[model samples]
Target: MFFRIINRIQPCTSQQRLLSRSPALQNSLLQQFFDDEENFGKQELRAKKRPGRSWTNEELRLKSSEDLHKLWYVCLKERNMLLTMEKAHKATARHFPNPERLDRVKGTLKNIEEVVHERNDAYYQLETGDSASAPKRTVTSFMGFTYEKRAEEHYSPPGEGQKGYEVPYLDDDAYLMQKLWNEKELCKERDRKDNLARRQLANDEMKHYKRGGRRTFDRLEDLKVYQ
Candidate 1:
């Protein structure tokens, strides 16, 4: 993927002769992995700027599917190369310039994915009356906690790659346990509300007393009593 983009980039003239003479030129991966510099290791290291703005969703949506696919790989390869360069610079205690360049690439990739997902959803809806979005269901864990589980692809079937595997489903006992837990939580919540209401009432009484509205028999006790 890197080689394909490098072959397409014709502007780097100074490195052309050097690249032609290098034995690694025969290997596309090695040739494109390294920066095209004659004085690569001999000179001071500095951050390099990315050439242009990231692809916008409008621009990507206008492109053909094949073109979008090609662009996605190109951005992916460029991101990998940038990260590799940054890693090397960090190892040598050198500063990498314009770290926001990575964010720009990442944003573009995210936009591209959203566009692709939209298209997929539209196609599936048209053909099968279903969206391409992953299916999700409410599932209870072995510990009796319930959560939404989104479907995903795995290399192996469930319970295949791990020991003592438990499917995320609740039995009658688990349901009963969860029900009891909820009841306890509700009781705690009601007690908290009652305490809060009493505190508020005490505060109001204190305010009334401060305004000289309390009688001699009112006691005029501190609000801390309610707490």
Candidate 2:
């Protein structure tokens, strides 16, 4: 699979071929995915000596919206390319080249999304005097733990008009499970306590033996008690 991509992918050479045959075909999705600039050839199968560094938050913040948008897509495309390469390598049971490129591209995409979110929030607050982030609520989960649930648009408040989803109450089966778990824990605690008491008794016997000489001690009986 890796070799197949390498053999067929000629980047600019392929684009030129397409241009000569039909200029309209150059704007195809396949051409877009098989971008012409980067190493669409076999060279990409080998690890890079040193790849470009990840985009910094400060650098991303300075870019205009349009420029940032374009950069985001470029990063996205690079990520897709890396993932495809990785899949091909894995399918052939080989190691992917330049694994760090995945992390770098992922980080860049995260930074881009964060910057965009900040900008959107600022704009939303300026215009509407409210936070732009999704509305979330603290709700209990089925396991009896609090979870942050993002509220979705509904006809009415949850659990009022509709059977709005709520953290489920423990049923008979759940109660039985909980009881069994508690019993198991209690048994463990009892066992641990008994073990500790036996250890203390054994230590005391050892102290007795140390105080009295070895000849005065009943070594076999003491060992039996400890065991």
TM-score of each: 0.54, 0.54
For all candidates, the clash counts are 0, 0
Per-residue lDDT of model 2, residues 1-227, tens digit only = 33454333333576435333443234566444443334433344334444688998899999999999999999998888678756655655555555787899999999999999999999999999866888787665444444678867778665754432455576666567767878899999988876765666555667777653233445677554333
Model 1: per-residue Cα lDDT over 14-116, one tens digit each: 5456445556556777655555443233333343423567888888899888987898888888788677656654555545555566788888899899899
Identify the runs in model 1 with alpha carbons over 4 angstroms from their true place: 1-31, 35-52, 152-227
Our model 2 lands, by Cα RMSD against the true structure, at 10.4
Model 2: lowest-lDDT 10 consecutive positions: 34-43
Q: What pairs collide in candidate 1?
A: none
**What's the CA error at residue 174 for candidate 1, in Å?**
3.8
Considering only N, C-alpha and C atoms within 3 Å, which residue pairs clash in candidate 2? Answer: none
